[model samples]
Target chain A: MRRGIGFWTGLGFTLLISAFLILPVLASVIAGVTANQFVGLSSGLTTRWLVEVWANYGGTVLLSLRIALATLAVTLLIGIPAAYVLARHAGVTARLVEEALVMPVAVPGIATALGLILAYGAVGDLRASWLFILAGHVVFCLPFMLRSVLAVLLALDLKGLEEAARACGASWPQRFLGVVLPNVSGGVLAGSLMVVTLSLGEFNMTLLLHTPFTRTLPVGLADAYTALRTEMASAYTLIFFVLIVPLLSAMQWAASRAERLGR
Target chain B: MSVAIRLAGCGRTWPGGSIALHPLDLDIAAGETLVLLGPSGCGKTTLLRLIAGLEAPDAGGRVFFDGEDVTRLPIERRHVGMVFQSYALFPNMDVAGNIGYGLRVRGVARAAARRRVDEMLAMMRLDGLGGRRIEALSGGQRQRVALARAIAPRPRVLLLDEPLSALDARLREQLRQEIDALLRSLGITAVYVTHDQAEAMALGDRIAAMEKGRIAQIGTGRDLYHRPANDFVAGFVGDTNRLATPEGERLVRPEHLALRRSATGGFTVVQATFLGPVVRVLLRDAAGRELRADVPDEDVPAPGERVAVLFQGRSLETEAAASPA
Candidate 1:
């Protein structure tokens, strides 16, 4: 009887926790679709706000895609080698390197953003441009890319695969292209997706270092909020939300597949 | 087909006080299987890796392949085939792709590579398994795929690092014979690493026993079994009952002992055990010093039974100093 009661309590707690987390998103979706606009509430299911934001608000969408792709390419080039060294090397030096890579992840994103702004903002001679925005995105996305790829790299059986390739007369580059790359491709995809997501959602760094011409999606969205463009801002948020939800879901799906693959 | 690989003072010491291998000289001959048999951490794997050029020896040491110094060459240029303890099949590739990896890397045309892969697949008895992903393969299947990959390019040398250690006993025994036959048929100079004495004796044409970063002894299985070089080698190569004589030492194989029906001399049977075809009798002297003997089942002795035993006087006792050289 006591076991049955305990089971019921646990199940109830899980349901309530899930509901608590999901309720706000559900409410926002209903509000987004149903709220009365200046055009007509009787047509109620109108997408006028989405159309207005897409047409007149800003070029936030384009900026977000650009930053995300650049971050993806740069992060992969840096993260793969960092992960390989950490995973393959043994002893104190490798451990120290691993911890150093993880240090930025332990730091708050706001701290990094502020530090960049101070260094490159009014005090530094460099003017804020798309270049500065990309630089910030790279810094912000580095930890995420490294962590995800490193996890996969560590989980792999390096001696097994590398030895097999070496024995098969595979040159180092061939081994990298054929054996190492294929095994780590899933991790790369997942890490690249993560970098893109982080770049797209970055608000703090974008706001601090953004120029009028170089504003990212999140920064533009915040500017819209300050100017009393709540409805249009909400529409922009919905579009951003639409783009992000799929990406995040895909990431979750990939993560679960990685788990099932058992590395 | 004849070849000889000479290791002229090969050595390697990783950072942080781990001595992976000590400077050593040895020769490996073509169409011969040399098993480096030792306990874990005894540098057996390190020796195989060094020979394969996966790891370089210390600056002064050199590795010679077929009379050519290949120590500085990269692993690919060395053209050595290696099978790891883990199967190491490429997870992303189908069985065919994994098998054809070496051929493709050697710049074989894609169509020709595929044909070679098919031939290797059939050779390894993996005909229909070509399209399956590595993840879909069973342990034995994966191991065979790895074997096929290693043999596909017909490398001059084959190195196996504890190849059968991962399999169950029955499978290990079965595959040991298969791999032995395969290596012999290919006429390749092979170095097999394992701590299993049974495996070493069963597969190695000559076995090099190692301990604590040095070779303990190198001999044919029968030679090492009957005439081990030292106390460590006697204990490691196979089971033995060792006794200290007024001289250096005397070791006797359990089976070499002859158990008589009566205590005609100073020996007495303390215990007896039936072990299928043979009966193992534990003998002792007046000083409670213990010894063991293995005789045919019909000559079985009971506990507390008195027995006469004799020692054979053939041994390479002076050969101890020359070992581990």
Candidate 2:
């Protein structure tokens, strides 16, 4: 297709905005590799800050991974079947239930976290555990998973497919496992990525919910930023990027591949 | 092994207290294709669903397969095959995977399932296309895959819910003929549903013309054309025009009505549509009683021309026309 001058102008403007957004992150990555942030790269590159960040905050990184996976598992377990059920009914009741599920996402994260603490804070074991923060993450992440899968289920010819499966003599388990899951794989993948991403990066709710012992990566990064040096904080950011980028890249590739495969 | 199906007072009612199909008894003979014919919302599909075990009949109702009571059996236990108009082929699976899904779920061994899938592909003229994805195939091919998948399980009864309605006119006709042959060759008791009267006529051994929530009439195409039990069946199964005969008003077809240009005739040609083999002419008399006649294109009178109408060939008095007066 031929493009007019307007397209070139738009491309230039977009590039300018991208550079503005990306230049800071690039500078941080460079600072992380430098021996000293004040002297910049001429001070000579070294892995000491990166190593220091890993040693000081490695447990938090591991805890964050655990939280993300736990949150994802909970969402998938409840969300997929919930989506199917809600998709099938599609009445006012179902809509009401969906909106209710999404209420946590719509409200302030800290408010939701405060509600959780008020309800469960009486139990000392529950309040101090990473599971408390995990609960907050699940509440925030589940709606994304449910809505993603629900949208796909609603868009599909789910009734026809179910009827066809039943008429083919397939048991309920067989139909769900073989037919429903494979057809909705794209949605499930997208939802999983969103759940994990949100759980990992979630700050405000996690901030209020987490105890010092249950510190997640983002909380640790904030601590490092406030109390530590620029080089160390920049190295912590680099570690965060290292932990998240490959996962994001893998999910993006999988989604594109699934798109190429027909629904 | 096809089995006779019987629905004894089988009916469906929604949770909202709306009746989709009123309690009615129906018997379908083994190896016969009984089509449920009606316009949408006439409960034809509801009846088919009742037979397929997808919908249970209301209280005091029962379904029997080959004289064995199967009213309580769900569709999986009933072991029936069904094809939908949308050709609901599993998009994730290739053609062969979709066809063999039934057999695989039924516990057929991998090798045996492959052999059966191959046989079904050949039977449906889908050879070498098994590796193709469902989305890769054209509409007709997808429908053929749907048919192959349904029949692969060797179901005792096959249910097709307007399977060919999604295709273009030419493809629909071609596939219709192929399906007719397939049903005949399989000899499995099948209940087909469609709103198209012509399709119902072409494929049904017996057509059940439904109206509202009940079967208005059930007979062969010829029987329906000649002897509709009521006005609904008469109008639905085929075009039937009212004729004011000497004895009383009677139903007639456009082909049976003869139109001739007459200077003194009270009927005026309202419109003449040339439809290739025949020209459909609409005429209205002084009383505004409209009559339609199909004639050769050469005999078409211009619009507003006066014409006389006469019933020929076989009128209401014909031996086959035994419908109640």
Candidate 3:
């Protein structure tokens, strides 16, 4: 095919926007390795800042991973069945309930966190525990999980599939395990990735919910940027990317696979 | 082995209080193939679902399988096989896995299930396609897999709900013949539902014609066509014209009507349509009553010509309209 002016123009515009989005991350990567970010790249490159950031915030990184995994598990356990019910019922009550689940996503996460703290703050055990932050992460990440699974459920002929299973003499539990779970596994995979990504990066809720000892990666990154040098903060950002890029790539792969499957 | 089925006062009313099927009784002898024939919303599907245990009947209604009460049983416990119009094959499973699912669910050993699956694959002419994915198959192949899956477990009864309605006309005819052969070979009691009269006539040993949640009539295809109990059945079974006679309104099939040359007091030929073997002639009388007659193409009269309509066989009275004198 022959090149056209419009095609070149659109390509140039897309490249320009991509550069605009990626330049900041590239600068951070450069700064994270620089011997002295204040003196610019000509000074030298070294891993000293990265080593310092890891030594200072390694526990926070592990805590973030723990909280993200917990959030993923809890959201999936509750969201999948809730989505199933919402998909099957499809009445006013189900609609209202679905909207209520989405309320956390629509409202600012800080407000939701504040509300949770105000309601449960009286209990010292819960308020001081890492599970308190896990609760806030679950609230923030659940809507995405439910929405993903519900989208797949609503698009499928699940009721017909269930009926077919029943006619084959499968009990309810057997049908759920054998038919429903396999069919919705793609949705569950995509949703789990979303939950982990959101929970790992979540700051607005964690800012209000986290205690000094229960600090997550994002909370620690914020504290490092404010209390430490710019190079240390940039190194923390690089580490965050290292932890999250694989999950993002897996999500992309799942999305394309679902498209290929025509679901 | 096939089991006889009996429904005593079975009916269904939707949650919103709309009657989907009125209370009715029906019986199917062991190894019989009964087709429920009706247009959409005529309650044919509701009756089939009631028998399948997918829907419970209204109070005072009961369903029996081999004279055992199964009214309270759910579909999972009913032990019936069903084929749906959409073919509802598990997309996650391969053809062999889909065919073997029922047996596995019934706690059959893995090797035994594999044998049954292979047997079904051969029976349905799906050899060499057992490992193929569902999305890789054609519509006809998917339907064949659905049938293989349904019958692999050898359930006591088979319920097919418009299974061929999704296929093209040519494929529908082919699969219809295949289904008829399979039913005969299995000798399993089956309840087939369809809106196509030709399909009902071809596959059913007996057909229960339903209308507005009620059974209009039940008989063999010959009985429904030649000796319909009422006008609805007469018109529903085949092409028919109602003619006013001294006795009353009489129903005559287009095949039975013969066109004759006449001057007046008969029908004037309005149009002639040649359809391969026979030409259908449309006629109108002075009373403005219209009738269609299928005559030999060689003897077709041109439009605006006058012809008398002759009844070749016995004309039926519209019992729905009035008593036959």
Candidate 4:
């Protein structure tokens, strides 16, 4: 069959949009590998900038990874049960508590950081550690985790399933592990990936909370941009792409899988 | 083994003070099958949940299983098997896993649980489908798996909450027969809840017809069919036509009224539809009130024919044994 004008028009628009979004990232990566950013790709690509960035800033990358995983762990530990309780009760008090948990996401990140610092800055040791950065990330990421799991739990026949398990002689923990957790595993996975994704790229709050010794990837990227060469900064962006692109894809895939299962 | 159940002054009221059930006493003998029959919002399910220990009665209410008070115990300690209308089978598990879950919860050994699961699969006529996913089964097969899952641990009581309502008519009838046989063979105290009168009649040793949070009547199917306690029970348990007899208003089933062709009769046959063994005849009287009569195929009457409707069962309302309340 012959293609129609509508198909070509749609194809043209899509290509235009893709180029608009992807061309800049491609240009940056190409410049990072090139011998020099000023001469562009014709100067020949080299791994010199990449190696230099890794040598000087690799600790920031590892620090970010550690904080992201810790954020995920803390969210999973507290958020799943919180979401379950919130979804099941669904009273005015539960709704109010959910709104309070989500307040961090709604507030400006810098303001949230300020609030946390003022509240706990007197603890000198905690303030000077990477754990301070992690605390900020958790506060920002917990809302997403709660929303994801809460949506799944609400869509389920939770009461019926629990009652069925109860009648089958399953104790409280057994029912939770056997019936509740497995049913919402998809949501939990999606939420975990999302928390990690947000924590890795978190900048505004992390900037305020991080000490010089506790600097994260995003803070290091800012340092590379403002205080280092252009090619080194682009190399930092490339490193970030390497770290978080696959995580974003997995998060999208997991969310869609959860949606399909809900159907 | 079986258990006798007794509920003394069991009632339920929501937090906002809406009554779901009135304070009423009920007793089910050991190995008895009592079906709670009602329409939507009639509290039949609430009554069943009270017995299953999934719900608690109001103040001063007590539930006894084999004369042991269990009102404060939750459902997990009650050893009751419950089958839901939605077939709440865990989707993550296969058919065998679903059936064996209760067994494993009871600390049954691995080999014993597997063997019991197999026995339950065979009993439910799902022997070869044990490894299949819950989503892969049809509605009837899923409900059968739910039954197997509930009864695998051999609980003291079985509670079914509209277990066959989701299936088509033919499948429902087939499953109803299977459940009837299962209940009889198990010899376990069972409480069945459904809005379907035919299902209650077929499976219940005695059916409790509920209306407005009260037990309108509780009796055998024959007793309820032949002698309804009130208008609500009369209308609920079977199809009935209210007739303005000289003895005030009388309730009569279609089979109880016989039609005879009479040129001078005040009623005329509006239509006759063939329904397999029994043909349903619709008639309109002089006052335009409608009546129906179920007759054998050999006694077919043409539409628009004048006929006299006769009360065949009570014969002018003389038998108190077959009278309406």
> A203-238 in candidate 3: lDDT tens per residue?
999999999999999999999989868899999999
TM-score of 3: 0.96
**Comparing to the true complex, what docking class would candidate 3 get?**
medium
- How do the residues A156-187 of candidate 2 rate in per-residue lDDT, one tens digit apiece? 99988988888888899999988898888879
Top candidate (DockQ): 2
lDDT of model 3 at residue B79?
A: 91
Candidate 4 local distance difference test against the native: 0.90
Cα deviation of A211, candidate 4, in Å: 2.2
10 residues in a row with least lDDT, candidate 2 chain B = B315-324
Worst 10 residues of 4 chain A by lDDT: A254-263
Q: B-chain TM-score, every candidate? A: 0.91, 0.96, 0.97, 0.95
The residue ranges of model 1 lying beyond 4 angstroms of the native Cα positions read A1-16, A33-43, A122-126, A246-263, B16-20, B243-249, B263-265, B312-325
DockQ, computed on Cα atoms, for candidate 4 = 0.56
Q: Can you give the lDDT of residue B84 in candidate 1? A: 84
Chain A structural similarity (TM-score) per candidate? 0.81, 0.94, 0.93, 0.91
Candidate 4, pairs of clashing residues: none
Better of 1 and 2 by DockQ: 2
- Report every candidate's CA lDDT: 0.81, 0.90, 0.91, 0.90
